[model samples]
Target chain A: MMLKSKVSIVKGLSYQGGLPMLSWVLHRISGIGIILFVGMHVAASFFVHVVGTDSNIPDLLNVFYESWGFQLFIYFCAIFHALNGLRIIVLDLWPQALQYQREMTWLEWLIFIPIYGMGVFFILRNAFAGG
Target chain B: MSARSTLRPRSVQPAWSFEYIMWFFTRVSGLTMYLLALSGVVGAFILGARTQVDLQTLLRWMFFPNRFHVEPYLDDAAFWVTAWWQIMQILIVFFAVSHGFNGLRVVIEDYVGRSFWRPLLRSVVFLLWLAMLVIAVFVILQA
Candidate 1:
């Protein structure tokens, strides 16, 4: 005998899924972070254009933007999102690739680490050297 | 047995629907922005961004290509102020703003579920997208 139930299962965020789950969560977070940064950037540029760059807001924004901390975070979000996005697209185009998801993620990091490391180096140098 | 015969046909969505169109746009626009950004970076390096500009200025130029952004750091920014760069900036603004807002809409749809807030939030995102495009274009052209 089969019985029908009205309740629905909600299988939300659980850490047990490991890397795939972490990647999915980070993708969404990075996306939102990029959008927020873009909004502020566009607004700052618009304000500077309208106010002739002498305004305090753009100056303050530049100071905040120039910080190594913010720079590293934004760069990480951007590069990670882009690389992970490419991986997702590849998987979509070739469903068979899903079987190798773990390997693909490792490849993504293999590419991501050196690129992000170089960016970090330049940013730190610029911050310390006052360039 | 051939692979085509062995596998079941996949279900397809109607291409004319809003969701379907947006899903396609997301992929296309993401690739388009990459192309545009690549061009910007290469063009900046060619235009002396490597030696003349600092890392920060080079980054700003790579992302936006606005003449004013780089002019402060360069001896001659005439190449950046040209119509070609303006066109690139405009294209970037259009694609990036549209892609970003659509992503936001997807996020809203995912979380808000079946509710009045879904449509309302979508409308808000749409209006913001429109406003962003307008302001961005205005600034680009005015520069």
Candidate 2:
């Protein structure tokens, strides 16, 4: 009897699960990621300002962009944060669509994987090849 | 740990105090980005007022990269130049995520009388930004 009911719960459209909460938590977590990357970018600019452009500042900045590891890290960060950003922006603007939130969250994640993978390929071709 | 200057109990930490410790990098990073943007704005204002475009000034402002408006408080140049960028990079990621998504999370938590569809829809938008932030950062860093 218990097993039969458990299967029905998942099969039913009304079923509640851990995903809503998980999606909520992760979405917020990614916002910080975007801010962090921007922060580093800002700090680097400051240094360039102080020293002037005659120095190795541009070269060093290029070095980071050229790095394969850094390239992948930044690319994924952009993809996840941007996709998730779209979802949260919609959620905040409209508060009545709670029902679709679960389904939308899953769709966003699915879309994110392929989008981010494509991003990785592009960065590797443009930035990593030189390094 | 010094006593917090607040009405809370000795055991109770102020909101900024605890969040500062755990999310130190992101907070600092946000500050950095804010300063950077401020600098750009200021530089642009100065340039906009100029009669003839100054080549030297333009290049300085353009390629100067991050606006170091906050660096005045940082005192440590070496740290800011190298280690700090990476630190800010990691932390900014965290803080932006937290601040941006807080709205959606709150709405979901308070979904009693609230028009549920709008906030949920907005949440989708925020999540997309989050995905872009993630995918872009990782791809850039890893590539």
Candidate 3:
């Protein structure tokens, strides 16, 4: 059973979910992903680089780090998290921009695709070059 | 904590006074993170470019010498010589960590409801966040 209410304080807001809401959710997820990566990266670097922890663990992690596939996933998360963050900042700073949020989201995607594409291309080239 | 600042009505009032402030910070930090992350990601690739090794070769080299001999490459004097790079790295790391932890807090609050263990869980999460932040700072500076 579901209760109907005008106001609900779920996911930090009392509003109906929509495009902007979706953006917020994605932003949260991406931000958390980056944070998790930071933790993993730091721990791995510490043991391998500083303490010289002898184990195959760092090697296994390095495999993922050096993979083009993983790089692309990270790049995607980073690019969206950043540009969507910019959109959020604009909306917050200029209240009027709220009306144009849908447009802003579209514009964000427009900008993101090309940059992400170029990044992917660069990573791929580097991977295949065997340099 | 019970005196109302904005007058709409008690029934429709916010649950917590700090909610508004936290909401504002979430957005502000979002903006900061956007700038920091953009530069950091691009800067990382650019710095890597300087080394001129591709993915496969780099891996083989790293593992061949000593299996997974990964070390903090950022500690390279080349990176430290540039102050702006270090600053960017620090800011990016801090803002990203803060924003993410705060966000996770919000998620737990929303979903955990009025559970007896909420405070304990939240505290554990916060402590872990603090520890991670400290370790991250140490690792970055050591680099």
Candidate 4:
């Protein structure tokens, strides 16, 4: 059996925990996803730039970037990561605010939606505009 | 879930110094990532439009010198090489990678218990990070 740490974090696969916990998990998952993307991007650029090879690098990147699904996924990840990053900074700056972390999480979601919506709007507009 | 139990007490702290260092690093890196990402997004927006400055111009400056040897290319490349934005983007890549990987480390530590597999998993993660760092540095620096 796993030794339980004193922290009251929710465990188990159900992950039915509240928003803070959910935020924790999503933040981690999104962060990891972004890392994978970054790694791929760096590696691809390495070949195109460092090795000075064409090798369809531009084509691959354009295809990936132009795909709606990939774009939306990256959009979501970017929004969540950015907002969550601010929330973290706030909490860290005022540790007392940690008590209101749940409220902060809710506020983060509230802030994330419209900003994200605007971003998606532009992204979709650009996509459809064929520019 | 009262406030009292929420925090680890001063008495039973495990590896307090190490945790403090990691916590400090996270905050510092998180702030840096936020700034870099913001600038990067701004750079992207500037690139998307047909402005005086664009992403390809920055790329040609940062990465591609041999492929595009036109006058404008060299001129744009020269202007951008010293530009703060180009440097910010490069640093962003490095910080974003480190922040993401470190975030993964936190996740693994949180979810995976102190089992024999934990160390093994960490080693694998570390190796992956090392490989990424080497490639990332090469790509970022070797124009």
| TM-score on alpha carbons, each prediction | 0.87, 0.39, 0.69, 0.72
- After TM-score superposition, the amount by which residue A56's alpha carbon in candidate 1 deviates from its true location, in angstroms, is 2.6
Residues A5-108 of candidate 4: C-alpha lDDT, one tens digit per residue: 66454545555678888887778777876776666666676777777675787558757855776767776886798789789889877776888899999999
Per-residue alpha-carbon lDDT of model 2 for B55-95, expressed as tens digits? 33332333232224223433342332443334444444444
What is the TM-score of each candidate's chain B when compared with the real chain B?
A: 0.87, 0.32, 0.60, 0.58
In model 1, where do residues sit more than 4 Å from their true spots? A1-13, A53-55, B1-14
Docking class of 1: acceptable
Q: Candidate 3, A30: how far from true, in Å?
A: 1.7
lDDT of 4 by residue, B84-112 (tens): 64366457555656666667776787778
RMSD of each: 4.2, 16.7, 8.3, 5.8
Reference interface contacts recovered per candidate: 0.31, 0.03, 0.36, 0.67
DockQ result, candidate 3:
0.28
Which residues of candidate 3, in runs, are more than 4 Å off?
A: A1-18, A127-131, B1-16, B34-79, B82-88
The window of 10 residues in a row where model 2 chain B has the poorest summed lDDT is B62-71
| Interface Cα root-mean-square deviation for all models | 7.1, 16.6, 7.4, 3.3
* Native-to-model Cα distance after best TM-score fit, residue B101 in candidate 3, in Å: 1.0
Higher-lDDT candidate of 1 and 4: 1
Chain A only TM-scores, each candidate in turn: 0.84, 0.62, 0.77, 0.78
- Select the stronger candidate by TM-score from 1 and 3: 1
Give the candidate number with the greatest lDDT.
1
Ranking by lDDT: 1, 4, 3, 2
- Positional deviation of A68 in candidate 2, in angstroms? 2.6
